[model samples]
Target chain A: MVQASSQVWSQQIIDDIHAKADLGRYRIRGFSTFQKVTHFDDLTFLSTGLTRFPLEGYKEKCSTQVTLGARYASEPLVLETPVYITGMSYGALSVSAKTALGKAASMVGSASCTGDGGMLPAEREASDKLIYQVLPSRYGFNPHHLLEAQAAEIVVGQGAKPGTGGMLMGVKVLDHIAESRDLPSGIDQRSPARHPDWLGPDDLAVKIEQIREATDGRIPVSVKLGACRVTDDVKLAAKAGADIVVVDSMLAGTGASGEALLDHSGIPTVPSIVMAREALRDMGLYGTVSLVASGGIRSGADMAKALALGADACAIGIGALVALNCNRDIPEADFESEVGVSAGQCHHCQTGKCPVGIATQDPELEKRLDSSEGADRVANFLNSMTMEAALLTRSLGKGDVRSLEPEDMVALTIEASAMARIPLVGTNKVFGWD
Target chain B: MVSLDAHSLSARELNQAIKKAALTGSQITILNPQARHNIAVGILDSCKIDIDGSVGYYAASLMDGPEVNIDGNAGWALGENLMSGKIVLTKDAGASVAASMRGGDIVVGGNAGARAGISMKGGTLLIGGNAGFLTGFMMQKGRIVVCGDVGDAVGDSMYEGVIYVGGDIGSLGADAKIIEPSETDLIELWGLLEQSGINDRPRFRKIVSQKKLYHFDNLERLEMSAV
Candidate 1:
């Protein structure tokens, strides 16, 4: 008799069920998506051969400069590079990590964002340009901080967990974190998924106006959404007076999110970007409101692909953490003793025992990461990515990164072709382009 | 004293002018307010603002330091998210008044609509007349005093706050119970009543949170039941 394999009852599924049964609790983790899905790698750039002339790499110049919030604000955020740092709160990461990210952003002439826990003074002081986040919970929100920010992002949802609220475990809710959020220490903090002030799109308009008034129209206001209903949400955000719309896809990282939400919610980044661009174009708001694409963007090639798909800029969160040595190899004994797992195999950010010290508040563990060293590493990573994107732009015979349009790319797979609205390789047929 | 007419200027221009005057600590007064919304919103400086007529939504919202006196009624979210200021409404106020206020004093001389003082952090809300349903809903840390009767579901899902009612309360919300007021609470209530210029002080019942909600054990049970 031949041995049989069961597809319905896989080993991984059985292990997961047994783990849940033994623990009697839902699993929590950091980062996102170990499952393979459609991504930017499925698309290939059509470099110059006959139709266009390629620029010289060393002598010729391809500008990477991008400006956000140009439509509404008197002072828009002008970035030297198209890459920006996405929001990651202080409670989720150590102060040293926040400071390092801020310093690196300043060094690269880009903007760093504050997350749901509010602005950290050290981050604000280190960064030359900062975007403040106003989340649904409004934790640690201050009108003065809004005035101080260079730009503001009104967060409707996060990519990893779209409909659910945020959770900070008791271990992460230390005294300072609790005080900042105005909650008691040693208790789990669960933030509401929806804003208490407004209910729908019309109310969102009023809230946007209120924020505009608060800032005296000096800074731009952006609306961020999880990539679920990309087209309709983008249209609504544009109509609601958003100067910029950020689409965070399912591949985005989180500090502390439920396992089910991270795996099962929101859409993929590639299709989300295409849908958002189409929506804005249909509404005649493509150029009026700048679009930012984020979630699982790991390299300069990905950045270039997103820009070609109509994103004015790209944001990186987990990639930035990895650049800051989030999973760097350490001594196995130390890793095992501290986190109960090897360095590269750890995802226990909710436990607050991060081995690499990038996502922890413990005093001893935090001391392992030096702010200057971390900043230098991140700055080098960003600079290299920018260079790669410039190379890609020059090869496509484009003088500016933003000029590499959708016509200059082709999809390697049918699903990618359908989702990105581009023609598949060796064929003139563009799927789903009707 | 500087007087401006709301009918003559747009809301933006009027607010800019008000901010300019407030920078020098001027006594500003407005005429024909005509239920204008967002009047004097986001004012950060200390100034005395007198509105002769009714105002609309978010009057004095995000105000840091200012004394606003509204002679007529106010629309929804009066003094919402106020920080270190005082708003005195001489007539009825609309729903969600003083919602999410951080630190300030909001006084309503007449009835207040539903959801007053919702998610209040730290402030004093004194209602001279009846308060509608869901008063002090999700209150974090603040003091709400209703001199008149209160409607149903007072202090719903409240985490930590103090609610005092002079008249009858229709129903207590989940995780809320009537408790005896401490000396400090009594003194605070009396001071608020005096500041609001209410002469008749009825015997008030204090309501506080039972601290039952917001635990992981309860949340796990809810998740299990849902499954």
Candidate 2:
């Protein structure tokens, strides 16, 4: 008898099709992509032994400090570590989660971004340096808030749903969330894909100027693009006078998104950084205009690999949330009974019934995660990540994380070799590219 | 009144000068404006600024409190994201006039380019002449008074707010419908026109959001079962 299951047609795929057919809409879920793309794990650093001596972990001072957006703004973002909390709005993540992220970043002398939901007052008060985001939705967009921000990030798009805007299910669009966004309660919010004022790149230049003018050029302005056409987008963003350009890859996390978009759209982090770095290099603006990478940055190894590939700094989303007990099963929550999936497999943030308190709007669920405790956990994770990156940098005989360049690493796979433009391991040749 | 020559100073220099001058609530005038971009931008204080010639993109944008009078043709995004204050344009204005303006008043004496008053959150935009395409797109609140004809898809995807068109409507946008203006609404609109010093008030037609596009049509199993 023939095998009932085929290799191409997995049960999960079949289930997805059935669910879509029944629902008459694309699947919606949280977290990032499940696509097995080449990532930071595919690159390995060539640590020093004979060519140079490695720095001692106990004695050597391997600085992880990075300054971003120095090209235009008088006051650039100064951080002790490269990793900062990326934008994940209040509507998407609970207030407790935002507060914890802010508190965590402040504890580590890093920055926390106020994502799509505008600057939550609680987060702003908790965060020492907050990146105020200007999204297409313009929800709760106040010029007064723009004045108070350390830096401003103009969001062109997100990696999870590249072409589309933010999606918050009606369940998550509670009264306060709706009130902040100036929308009616219980309406499923779909943010506009295009900015209201500016249209194209030329217009974006003027818009950047407007932002600079609005803030008196005191803080740097960053243009955050969902990584798709990385080369051209990066060039355009730089030419448009962005102080920093953030390349958010497909692996970036989201609160809620159409499952099709998460799985199908955008490029992975490995190639995106290479393309963006080369794009800036072509314009002779590589180091002049800062490049920030955000996507599936999991550990210190990933951060170190990305820094070596040309990312000045890295922004994290899901990893930080995980430290805040996002998917963890606590004693107060029942994953199987509440969300139908176990703690590790659940992606039900769109449902507003999160098993962990990080992603929900419900009062009882939000109570499960203590902001102060979550802050401690996240700060510990950040410290660990910074040490890991610094450890690898010192291993490469480097005193600073920024000194770890592409020549210090090689790709483990042929796909990675081509995408990262680095030589393959044990081979001088870079595969698939001359 | 202090006057600065636009040709002599750089864009940065001119804006900085304006900011410095606006601090003292001084009335200032710009000479040889030359259609420069970002003129008198970020002026937060309530002061009078007169531009002698044409202006370029983002003219008088991101301002909180300043009454600016542009004497010639204006470029795109005139008075964009204005918090409070007023801007009067004497000639044709480019696209996205008063775009995303939260509060205050903007009066364009001539025709306005496409996307005039797009995504307007609050305040009043009075276009004395015709307006181009997609005017008042995604407008959350406030009033747009277009005295002359409007191009295609006017009031497209407006969530709330009333667009009073005095002349012909090229066509209506998705989820936009024209309705007879109430006497009180017309009286209020005409009163605003009178305040802006526009003499004639044609037969005004009010366009509003049908409110059908507010929410999605369907939901998933988890969404349906969610609390």
Candidate 3:
């Protein structure tokens, strides 16, 4: 008798359970879920027809300039494009990769952020505008670096692993990464999930004041949060005097994260951006503090969609890695030999043996990526994204990308309509708003 | 010499004045500090600052080279992230004193609140009296010498640091172990005690990192350890 293909317990589920039982530990990997979920793809732009006049693509110029941290900062982050590179730590990526990211961001007139391991001097020197992250672990946190930064981001949580501290496996904890973080070489490092100095939101206010005072109120101070309780967290950040609120949704990528967190934690970017916008608007601070949307933001279309939903800017993490040939085709035998997985099927970033060399610290693998070539690739990707966003903005008859409003967008699905608070396709009603 | 009355000036104004005075290598004195927050913050020059009265939060925070002498009590985070400076507090200090200090010396005359010398990278914190809970918590590299009793959970999750307590210890934190001090350690402790004017040489207990908790070799080992 022929067996049925559609079993009650799928082979994937069965394999996952068996794998957990065998290993006795949850799987750790890079990037987020491949599961089909609601995202910005469920939304479509309502480009100009007869009601709105579309600008000529070649003749008319669409501005994508954005200013972040204008609320309290004397010198806010000014970018030529609304798309920026999100934080990725030095320990997770090689020094060459970090330098490439910095150089690429600088070439595009954008900002690159440092992550949990602290600042890398090469990255700092390469990038014109650098945003330093003040993580809970306080690893490599110093007043001098804080002062040197164009902006300081207080990382409350990351979208890939919310409510959990950062983890760097012993394999990647080489000499420099270890020394910069003040940890012994070849030791697994786990950062605290919470800041040692402060406990709650009230304490956060005091900490923000301290950071502002430390920077002499010159550069902006941002509070970055994973997309959990978006409305409440954004409101709290606003009240705590954060110049910018970076909302990273569950779809955001990480160098290393537990499978449990990546699959079953936090909300998606589509709803998170809407909730954050509504929160800021309700608090009467819609235009005061800038909102940066991140997580699974792949293309310029995603950037335009985010801007229409009221994000001042969109940050790309995984997309930037992809641009740097993260999962591109390589020699299948070489990939298998390095990561024990075939090319295009690799997610073993936690293993410190990346085949394409974008996420590994091993000198042999790291040498695969040339910094100048990587920077050129990143720059090309950024330029393409900017052009795509500009195309969308000009088609909407908007002079600036920031002027793209929710009225210019329509949801393709019911859930998208409700979550985005935009009208459904070929309909006048937005489920939640209408 | 520069003299400023903190009562008439805002914290920002006073800090600005202090910064300006520090530029010319002048001796600055602040009168009626009245527990003002962030007094003499971010001082980067080699100068001397004397606070005649008690100071509020973050006094001499992120100080690089200034010698800050507080005649009265200090509030939270005194000399926070201090880099190459000397902060002398004549009276008690609040929680998180000298937190994350890199290179400096902090001498507190009286007792201190919780989390003294927390995450200290490289420095010397000498407390003439007792310290509260979680003292030397997560200390990476530093030396904390307390002359009086210490609260519970001393040196919690500490990586590399030496904490010497002259009085009784309430409890040791995770991965923290008491070790017998060497002759060199005793000499160093005695020298620090002498400098802090701690004449009574109580039996000192030394705490250091266990180092085993830093990594997980395998899944089964991690599970067994967790259990």
Best by lDDT: 2
Question: Compared with the true structure, what per-residue lDDT tens digits does model 1 show for residues A208-302?
Answer: 87777777888989999999999999999999999999999999999888898899889999999999999999998898899999998999999
Candidate 1 residue-wise lDDT at A239 = 95
What DockQ class does candidate 1 belong to? acceptable
RMSD of each candidate?
Answer: 3.5, 1.8, 3.0
After TM-score superposition, the amount by which residue B185's alpha carbon in candidate 3 deviates from its true location, in angstroms, is 1.6
In terms of lDDT, the poorest run of 10 residues in model 1 chain A is A330-339
How well is each residue in B121-227 modelled by candidate 3, as lDDT tens digits?
Answer: 87899999999999998888889999899999999988897999988999999999999888888887887778777787767889999997887645422222111
TM-score for chain B of each model, two decimals: 0.93, 0.97, 0.94
Tell me what TM-score chain A of model 3 achieves: 0.97
Clashes of each: 0, 0, 0
Docking class of 2: medium
Instruction: State which candidate has the highest DockQ.
Output: 2
DockQ of each: 0.29, 0.55, 0.35
Q: Clashing residue pairs in candidate 3, if any?
A: none
Question: lDDT of each model, Cα atoms only?
Answer: 0.86, 0.90, 0.87
Q: What TM-score does the predicted chain A of each candidate obtain versus native chain A? A: 0.97, 0.98, 0.97
